[model samples]
Target: MAEVHTVYVPRDTTACSLGAEAIAQQLGRHLAMHSPDCRLVRNGSRGAFWLEPLLEVETEQGRLAYGPVTPEQLPDLLAAGLLAGTTEHPLYLGPVDDIPWLRRQQRLTFARAGVTDPLSIEDYRTHGGFVGLKKALSMTPQALVDEVKASGLRGRGGAAFPAGIKWQTVLDAPADNPGNPQSGRKFIVCNADEGDSGTFADRLVMEADPYMLIEGMIIAGLAVGADYGFIYLRSEYPLAHQVLQEAITRAEQAGWLGADMQGSGRDFQLEVRLGAGAYICGEETSLLDSLEGKRGMVRAKPPLPALKGAFGQPTVVNNVLTLAAVPWIIDQGGQAYANHGQGRSLGTMPFQLAGNIERGGLVELAFGPTLRELVEDFGGGTRSGRPMQAIQVGGPLGAYLPAAQWDTSLDYEAFAEAGAVLGHGGVVVFDDTVDMAQQARFAMEFCMVESCGKCTPCRIGSVRGVEVIDRIIADDNRAAQLDLLAELCDTMEFGSLCAMGGMTPNPVRSAVEHFPDAFGVTPESSAGAA
Candidate 1:
């Protein structure tokens, strides 16, 4: 009998796109012919995208890694003793953690992301999963809410609302259980419809370490006295949807997500519902509307989701990151998690290094890394090998910071002061060749396309914005056009119904402010100041 060996391969979407599935299948065949005793395991991505189809072998020393493996190299890799970690392959990445990209990350919410089998409840548990949920089961709902509150956690889904405060409303609000009117049903909803450009944190959690999210939601359900929870995932994430469903089923079978959980006497049910892929559904109100099978539109908010969300019941709406952070806060005391970062931005954030960056992937870190450090040091500059020009922090709707503003820190208040936002912790870089005017115009065009049309400022102002930016780019009535653009942005910012238009002005204004030449304005004339 051949000795048994364990092989690890990624099931992450990016890895799959780069042929991870094919590589896994081929690995099975290769081992069957060459070394049949090897058993393969499909795990989540290491967030080192450039090294996709990364293969790992569980040796006595540790899990040795190899990367970007292709079908043609399988036999050579095998012949070179790849599984035994003796191969001198150029793609070898040594031990996974030894990689600088993986080492630098603070990785709290994403600690188990690349290490665990996404659908394996057993794998999840063996790797420090459900400890939070276990702890929450013993604590009173108020105590659980207080723990999260003390953790200094704010919503990671752009709003930055205190999650404990949001959950408190659900804890205090009257549950509107139409099915059992007297019993009072509340809800926990995970806003997994992550539509932000350059942001994949939610998707990574859903597809890679889904149990972390499930555990977080379970804690949330327990804390709010909610009997039901839903993960509103976007249709674009077929892999995430599939894996999450599998994980949910497994959790239910193991008695982690059934009607009665962990013998806690509380009843809860978890489900994954697909969204229509509309960007507006990212907003909690629109997400609630979509969850109800209504058109994905933002509802007016005085009632707040905490008071009247999800079928008129008090609801706790949290994004993937916010929910995923709960288990960490529970396992490590809230204060332990709180002590890592600066100011109100306590704890780690999964910063997605995207766009023109050379070493693009996820970089989870404590708050306070300057934009320059992220783009220049961690990212290793641009993939084009050109001088990095602009850095777009947050998502598409975020402001584009110029070189002058590179020293800006990662704290939410710092970004707010700099006229930008750390929306969803996405960082997109641009080389010197990027045209700021066209990019600025795209901000308006994106708003016009994605606007829910709930108000005049967003629906009409976005259309007018495009026209003005075009004139600015063409130098046609450039002076008046600049003035009109500024005024139009202010209207959209102040009057828009939701962030679709309200925040679109951020990128547009930032680009116009920093790069006047792109809009055909001479910097010395003060006309660009508009």
Candidate 2:
């Protein structure tokens, strides 16, 4: 065995803050001058924030883990033969894969995530990557869509729509008619505007495995007969944007992108576009508007993005995770990938475990994992180590469930039945310290700030909702205010144009229903609307 060894460190934005890059550079220098056998591989984050700058050393015991390393300590550590003793570091003890949080993950889309050097084609190839592209090159487009359908994968982005159905719709659309009617251009738009708080999965994937997204888009283009693809990214993720740009350049130069990819007749090209910090842009049509350089506003449905999107063309607009998962599904057989999940939800979901929680990180799992397991076992309870009171599943649009409902499964339909949503799989845990009324008010304030003001209920209703919450909290006209708020929420939910208006009441309603004491409102106070 070589006296020297290789180390893997995360480079995702979250990991970088914990000093991942500096650690990698220091380790590399040490390997170059002092230890000829030692090498270092700068890898994408493993999605574990607290253990960032995590060093995974190749050892007889497997990949030994140590983390949150700083560059200044390299010399003494290197001199001590740290590579030889994998368990010596305070953070080191056992194989990283065997760690309970990591072990529990189903890891399909994220199979190569924290494990490989994301940019190196050689590294990716060595780890069973690009096999999907190779297999896809051998099959026809229709056959490819059929394979996806067999996999039973749905969009991991909030909606949980069937991915294969969207592909088929675009493939089967009517061609542009010259005189009487004509088929429009086919497009594949990747929704990378991940504006939800407590959710960084999309940004993590783009920063860590940019090539995967590009490869997935290329495969989608081939599957849907589309020549052009666009990734609509949020401006907040500057590092992710930069990383993706570099990856696209690398892939294009490597014959993985651009016209006539690898001498194959497929003429697919991809480009990245930045969104001007609009939360609604995460929605498909609003994303299209931002791509076209218009204000990000929700548009009507019926002619879904699949039927008419991006300049009135047949297009497939999917989320970052949804698109990133494609290459893997293609490489592996559909049944092989589909066999992991339960019920209507299939395959592993890359859930973003964040906010006021211990062991906060990325957790990829099959659909049936109960919220209780995610919060108690994986999250390890609240960050304050206090008993948790409420947990919010999904984004701001999601419902706040009291601890009694923790047993509910994480699937989309199950969450919907429980008056919640698995929107982008962001689970935020709040301990007893949390004020439910304040959280409820913050939801409305977020909506008010983000609402494009295109619709009456959302534009006017959110401000009123916040005022009503304030009135209820102040204990003045409490009963009338509570009644008014309920009536207002019902109006916005039923009369609003899009989810922005419709679902904003979820947090408010749940807070009011579950913890009425937080609002300081009596039962009689809810009797009449002011």
Candidate 3:
């Protein structure tokens, strides 16, 4: 085994894009020529995409960090004695965890994020991994659910529904179902679609600590009396998909998964299923539809996926983060996890700070943090380094929050009060360069293009929406067009079946209300209103 004190670089897509690999190759030559005692490891990313070509040295003080450190600058960094802790590289920051962006996060699901060689089971076990499964095996299935109930964990899959309650529902299903608890026929599925444009937390977790997701699924299966699991991940993330499959294989062969998991007398099996790039399939029912080999269309609510899911049997459908966080909660006890966040939104949230934002990466935080602190302080404003004009919280279905509402806390209920959703905890920043009218129209256009075409309001309403925005933008019948646009938004708000139709107007309506001048409408056109 190599010494803990080693030089490491991230090899995730973002780092690779910035040539971290080439830097590693160069550093390997330098290390062989100079310090034979030094070891270097190419590891997965820390999810800090912007800090690519990042270098870390295990220092006596802690794991000291430096970033965007290219091979071109290696001579200086080496001469400065990075290994001896005498380096003052501008990128050198003491302890990766001490960084405000990474430190503030509660990090149950992200416990192993930047610290370990992601694919190594030994690294995982050394960090207190698999404790949840060992603890779960000692309890009855019903008792396991009760422990989760005490943990105050809500689904992180855009819906804040309680995870324990969902598990209870599956356990309550009749025992007469086709398969016995040990038969491996019943299953749990992780929804890794994560189609939200600005969000990448789930993908990062899978790429970094895929076994956490697998372990979480095994715990879900144990608690809910299921014997098998499937993770329906998106195809766009080939790296995540590949990493997850390899993790599953490793878990199975090591007896961490599959029948007789960890010698607990429990039978559980897991696998990965890839999605063909349909955003609509992120919806739980729609995900099940796609999993069943059918078109991905949103199904009406009433019988939630927890009750009747995946092949019409009782199933637990959870987001990757939601499931990934379970092992930590269970291992450390419920109260330790529950005490981290604000009321109603308990536990840490892996907020994906991206898009026009300056700090574009995963920032896990306690729930009470304000959106302003998240976007400005952690994100450091827009990528272009301009003052933020408008911000969209949640995904595209969310509202366009003006600068005035930036003080709102990042919680489900708090965001709901501002007429926004913390859907998937994605905050997309926009500078003054963004056109509000264009952004509004793009929301409806997204809905129109992605709509399953099952209903009228979303299908027909979206096409008309494009024309109305064009008219408003072109200054044709200005006031009348604005009023007409408002009317159409109202109809979409109340008339649509699912969020696709119902919430598509949120961005448009908020944009219109907050930035009226951006619409390019004038009072003179109001003369026709009479």
User: Which tens-of-lDDT digit does each residue in 362-431 have in candidate 2?
Assistant: 9999889899998878888888988899988888998899977899988888888998899998988888
Q: Every model's Cα RMSD, please?
A: 1.9, 2.3, 3.0
Clashes by residue pair, model 1? none
In model 3, pairs of residues that clash are: none
For candidate 1, what is the TM-score? 0.97
Best by lDDT: 1
Q: Tell me the whole-model lDDT of each prediction, alpha carbons only.
A: 0.87, 0.83, 0.82
Question: Compared with the true structure, what per-residue lDDT tens digits does model 1 show for residues 354-422?
Answer: 999898888899998888888777889999999888999888789999999989898999999999999
| Of 1 and 2, the candidate ranking higher by TM-score | 1
**Predicted model with the maximum TM-score:** 1
Candidate 3 lDDT tens digits, 1-530: 12345888776767767888788888788788877788887677787776767788786667878876776787787777766755466767668768777776667777788778778888889988888878888878888788788888898978788999989988887535455443334569899999987888898888888888888898899888888788999999988887888888888889998877767678887878899988888988889999888999878876777666777667899999889988887898888888889888988998888888766888888799899988878889898978789998888988989999999999889998988899898889899899999998899889888888777888899999999888888988778888888788888888887778788888988888887778864454343221
Worst 10-residue stretch by lDDT in candidate 2? 175-184
Give the runs in model 3 whose Cα sits over 4 Å from its true position: 1-5, 29-37, 79-86, 175-185, 522-530
Task: Output the lDDT of residue 300, model 1.
Answer: 90
